[model samples]
Target: MAAADVIFLVISIIAVGAAALAVTRKNPIYSALFMMVTLLVVAAVFQMLSSPFLAVMQVLLYAGAIMVLFTFVIMLLSLRPEEMGETAPLPQRIFAAVVALGVFALLAFPAIEPGVPAAAASLAPPAAEAVRFPPAAGTGDGATVEFGATAYFGHTIFGRFVLPFELVSILVLAAVVAVMVLAKRDLSKRDVADDGSDRDPPPLSVSAAHAGSIASLATSTQPTSHGPGA
Candidate 1:
């Protein structure tokens, strides 16, 4: 096998291991970290797939930016042990495992099934027979660029999908703002609890309040105003 195939296999193994750790980790931060590793390895796989632009985006957009955002949100939430909740019930765990296995089988079957072409032409035709991309411009000049080349992807995205793209940016911005708000609210609550711990006395019980009222009534019998001055 070629060196490229060996590298690809190594990357794929790392990606799978990291992904499994990401899924099974009890700590969300660890899970997120493992997920970041998986994303980075996936980016390397994308590079091996001859998709340099996708590789760069997978690194920048997912492994870098999105992971940072997720980390911030997770830290801000500060989930407690109780909030993490008890382990899943046996039935739920079993169900989840079954579903995961089903999905794995579905994805694996197409590649491993006997008689399927190495390129999986049964599922998708050879690249040569694939539908052609709409050329960057009319056919006046015989110019061609690979789809998702840096220049081509940028032009296609900004030209055709600009509005949806902008909307997604807005959504990400809104999520960041929301996370900040939630973090501020959480911090403020913590501050109040810490600061007020001594300042706010425990509430009076009913019996204590009644006893205090009776004491006040007893002490009121002095009646200074109705004494000798009257």
Candidate 2:
């Protein structure tokens, strides 16, 4: 087998494994870390497919920025282990597994079928030998960059779609502000409840109740001696 093919398989395995670990982990921090690993592996796959711009964006947006946001939210929420709660029921988990398998089959079908690639060069091989689209723009030294090249995507995103790009940033900022508001409200409510403000106090334990009863009995008996008028 070719080295490129081996490397591709290794990266694919790492991505899948990390994604699985991320989903299965109980700790939010560990899950976030594993998810970052999966995202980085996906970026590596994009780079291997000759889309350096996409790889960089994946690393920057999903792995770096988004992960940081998620971590920040997790820390702010301060979700405890008890608050994490139990896993889904067995039947629900089974149903989810079935759905996941169906999605996997849909994704793997075209790749697994030999007729598609053999019939036409629909899917190109990876690395430098891969198919190239129309040339985008020429470099300073009279070198032409292809459509899948980084320069092409960068130029298109920054030049023509700058407004949409800035709009997305604004949207992300809005989301962050919304999360902070909700978290602060929730924390205030939690603090109020803990302070016993307008909430019923906890019931006394059996031993405490028994001790109070004994103390009351003793006081009633001793008070009889001092009640000479009665």
Candidate 3:
């Protein structure tokens, strides 16, 4: 209800709107710019919340670094020709629009309909008035608590939940490798044959058709070589 809260809400709403536009925009460059705006607005909201760490991360990681990368990638790929092609089919286009509308409805329905408020009531813990446990003696020294020391990085690789983490890492590595391999073009087969240009030799099927027409074209295009100059 405060002025600051109202400002924060307005910024958040604009950030969400810009992000949606980023995904739906027809021009990739404009989409990237909108994404950058969304990220900057999110960083501002984080700053308003007093979380400087998250705010800095949002600005540096997303707005500065990731958005630049996205913009450069969109520029690198020559998509102008493809952009002029036909749009999505009517059935698929309608289905996607319906799904998007359904998601918006789900988000808006809760805000509009107010029921008995039983859901909120049920979320309260039954032991709300339970006695608290006193802190163990000598535990509150000036030393900082390291949360992940025993649970993760410093622990053995075979620790609990390690399998899930390893699986995720493997999946991400595989995806990176697959994308790199697929993006690469095979130029090893390109070589200079009797022709001047360095290009891949024609396939057997094409070469056979070319061979059949070569004699006829050569007879008409080039004079016959005779022993004496006539």
Candidate 4:
């Protein structure tokens, strides 16, 4: 095998291992760190594949930006160790492992075998050609439109799959709006009473209320001194 192939294999193994660790880690912060490692290794694999644009995007979007967001959200939530749920039962985990191994074996058999070419030829004609879009107006008739990485991505996303892409954006927007709505306090219900005469007090933090109660008790229990004549 070529040196490039060996490097790609190593990177792929590291990426897979990091992904598994990310999923299995008990701590959210550690999991996020592992996920960053996975993303970085995947970006390296993209570079090995001669896709510099994809590698840059993988690093910037996944490793840098998305991982930062994920870490921020995880820290903001402040989940306690006790709040984390228990792992799945051993039997259930074993069953899942078996299913995953079966799928991997099914996929690997065709990939590792030497009959892939024969299978591909049987599936489609060897002379089958790719569909190419027309060249730009300034370009000659015989010249085909040559698309770089960014241009090809833009064309695929905005040209043919524009509707789905737009719908995905709308879905993301809706999710954000929903989360904001859920996080907001329900002031409308608290502001009005049954007869619309009394308004409920805003909810106070437990520690603050406890401290206020303690202060009031201390003030009430204080002994008063009187003059001798009194």
List, residue by residue over 13-102, the lDDT tens digit for candidate 3: 999999889766656566667888999998888778665566777898778866665555444443443333445578987998899999
Model 1 RMSD in Å is 20.8
Please provide TM-scores, in order, for all candidate models, with all chains considered together: 0.58, 0.59, 0.51, 0.59
lDDT comparison, 1 vs 3, better candidate: 1
The residue-by-residue lDDT of candidate 1 on 88-199, one tens digit each, is 6789879989999999998888677876665465564235522243444555222444554665566556765789999987876666555455435354464446656657
Q: Which segments of candidate 2 are over 4 A away from where they belong?
A: 114-142, 154-230
* lDDT of candidates 1 onward, in order: 0.64, 0.63, 0.57, 0.62
Ranking by lDDT: 1, 2, 4, 3
Please give the distance, in angstroms, between residue 161's alpha carbon in candidate 4 and its true position after superposition: 2.1
Q: Considering summed lDDT, which 10 consecutive residues are worst modelled in model 1?
A: 221-230
lDDT by residue (tens digit), candidate 2, 69-98: 565555544554445445567898799899
| Tens-digit lDDT track of model 4 for 1-230 | 99988888898899899988976665666677888999999888877766667889999977887677666555544544434444557898899899989998988888788898678768642222213544435644324323335544555567777999999978766665555455447736645557857664432232222333333322222122111121
Error of 2 at 215 (Å): 50
Worst 10 residues of 3 by lDDT: 221-230
